[model samples]
Target: MQTQGHDLVSTLDERTSNIRATIENVLVLPLSRHPSPRSVLIIGCGIVGAATAFFLARRGVDVTIIEREGPASAATGAADGAVSVASKRPGPMMVAALSGVALYRELLGDGTLTDLFKPRSTFVVAASDAECAVLEAHAGALRGEGVAVEMLAHETLIARFPALSSNVRMGAEVKGDGHAIGYRIVNRLLSLSGVTVLRGVEAYHLVEAADGRIVAVATSRGELSADAVVIAAGNGAPTLLNCDGVMKPRKGQLLVTERAPALNASMPGSIMSGRYLLSKGSQKGAEVSARGYGLVVDPLVTGQFLIGGTREDSDARQTNDLEAVRHILTDAVAMVPGLADIRLLRAFAGVRTAVIDGLPLVGRLPGRNNLFVAAGFEGDGICLGPVMGQAIAAMACGETPSLDLSSFDPARFTSLEVAA
Candidate 1:
């Protein structure tokens, strides 16, 4: 990290030595520039901000990212990394997910993320008729989008995974889905994509020019100049942007079991309960219904089954409650009988950003020309981040985005009071 100023590292340890070499695989750059920047400043280092920075850099944009912590330190760190499109609801959300699938394909094709982009099938199993209906409809929706889906009957599903409880009525398999380690991809994007980063600084205030356009941001590290800013800071976005209730935090708990003994064969991808279908997006008068039943029995690459999760409409103070863990595991054991014998290692939690309307707020902020908002992705951030990043970048460059973002306008719910 070659910085012209000593103040940049005044409070740092030796980790700032190479910036990029701090981690074996991470790449980092310091805040250094010639004249004032006409560049864009992204206020998060999660998947969305990272992808936005990557695309912006490709467009010759001088990018400076101000991350309160390190990259992938929050929501991105806690992601299951499932690139499953079937999990997306119908309409614009699914359309963006299709774009995400295409982006993953392009990224995989160019060897950008092939190694970490694990191509695996996603198995969604239903234990009851109601769930079977949901699974059947979900498969039809996926097939409607031209996604390859294979529906399985109860008997056929048993033949595939005998360890699965007989209660599982049916299942659907989507072969094209892939999973990636969230933090790994964050580091890979930083290493391969060009962006200057200032870690441990919270972007506090937005400085405006005489004509009222955003010119810079005041961070904990001091004022960093900018021409445009993207608020992809996830759960922290509301406070930073003063969007108030626009972006609320949704809490979830997950458990990682000890390495499994030799499994029957490798379980095909992840085994999602029909309950998982209920949690895809918000339901009318049913926002709270998706709280504790999205159980997934995911066998990780490390032979450890990654069991999860409980979606609580709570604040950042929520932890991995024991009862929630018990409930999640109960659902897991019901779906996969063998999981009852699996030793539990640890239980953890993460907060996802949810909007009032259940859709992400993309494009420029309501009242500001240069302030773009890409928060409120909730649990779908891992799937929609790449496409949203590209679309937001196109909007920033004054070009028409290929994705129709009219429905996702950040100002849809309320008219922001900043500028018009």
Candidate 2:
């Protein structure tokens, strides 16, 4: 009688398991049959590459992001998260920045990515009457684009940012501008579902078919075959692509200050000089007037202050440029008097992948059917990450991107013969 009872219980348990399995299959059948999913291989794990992986994974693409060392160990790791509209070019880049800001705000509201972002006002200070006029024009142009901008006098600028030096001539206040921590954002995106992050793996070459379709990627560890691949390896991209003169590594030095009470209270948001915000294309005509220095200060939530940086037009990996550090520190202290007393904590450097045309290359590679390129962000990768990822994922999935990306075409710098 005891043996018969045990057998009956086992039978009932098996029946319950079968019922549950049937229900699960019924629930997942529609989704599985919607479309055949394709696997994607992202070549870098910086902000641009990680964010691209996140966006693609969210769209149900099987994503595997391979990094040489670790996530954000390159430019994204050392970036100062200044998501400012002032830093971008006038047209499509600016539009994309604004769109990314909106997406960040939405993510914050949804509590999905709140820890990665912080909302703060951004200011552009002018040091002379000419710069003040330029600020006025910039403010007007931003306002014309429906962005919230306020022009403030020197006195008003001093009052609003009490830490600002009295020599500030004028300022433009952008209400919605803020900063996002880059590495944190990358980690958050990596933790999402449908994404596989492989650190300490270096991508070496692209394995393409005779038809010019990328079929596999050769890496230091091994080969990874994918339906599509995105090259976002920052300055390392040009080396991997074997494409000459497509990307160059521009070094930037930054410094951090020990946590200080005086500096905490006067933490002015992302600050920029009017000349620094001028179009890079206009630098040739105003080379003598342009200052190679820009100051950005943010009082991190940890109480430590972040200050940066000097754009050095070199590809070297030397981070200990004491002269550049001294210049940056002097300018930062000049902008925020309270920062003068702060103790120097540490200094670091990052190489920004810059393009000759001063815009990131996005979209499919010319003559390559399944390969894509999304690098050369320079200093704006953190700000441009989301939109670039969205565009890349859209192209991979055969969907139309929400934003127009004509300005970021890969063939823009290439001749017809080279592109073909």
Q: Rate the local accuracy (lDDT) of all candidates.
A: 0.75, 0.73
Q: Model 2 off-target regions past 4 Å?
A: 1-37, 278-291, 415-420
**TM-score of every candidate relative to the true structure:** 0.87, 0.86
Local lDDT at 30 for model 1: 35
Model 1: per-residue Cα lDDT over 1-420, one tens digit each: 123123322312232323324322322223223222236789999999999977776565667678999999898898777887867777777778888877888888877776878777888888888788778877888888788889998899889878788988889887787777788888877766546678888888777666667766776865666567788899877776666767678887888999885662458778887777686542223345446559777777778878878777754654777788889888888888788887899887888898877888888776677788898998888878888888888888777889898878877867444322
- For model 1, the local distance difference test gives 0.75
Candidates' RMSD to native: 6.5, 9.0
RMSD of 1: 6.5
**Pairs of colliding residues, candidate 1:** none
For model 2, give the 10-residue run with minimal summed lDDT.
Answer: 27-36
Per-residue error for 373 in candidate 2, Å, reads 1.0
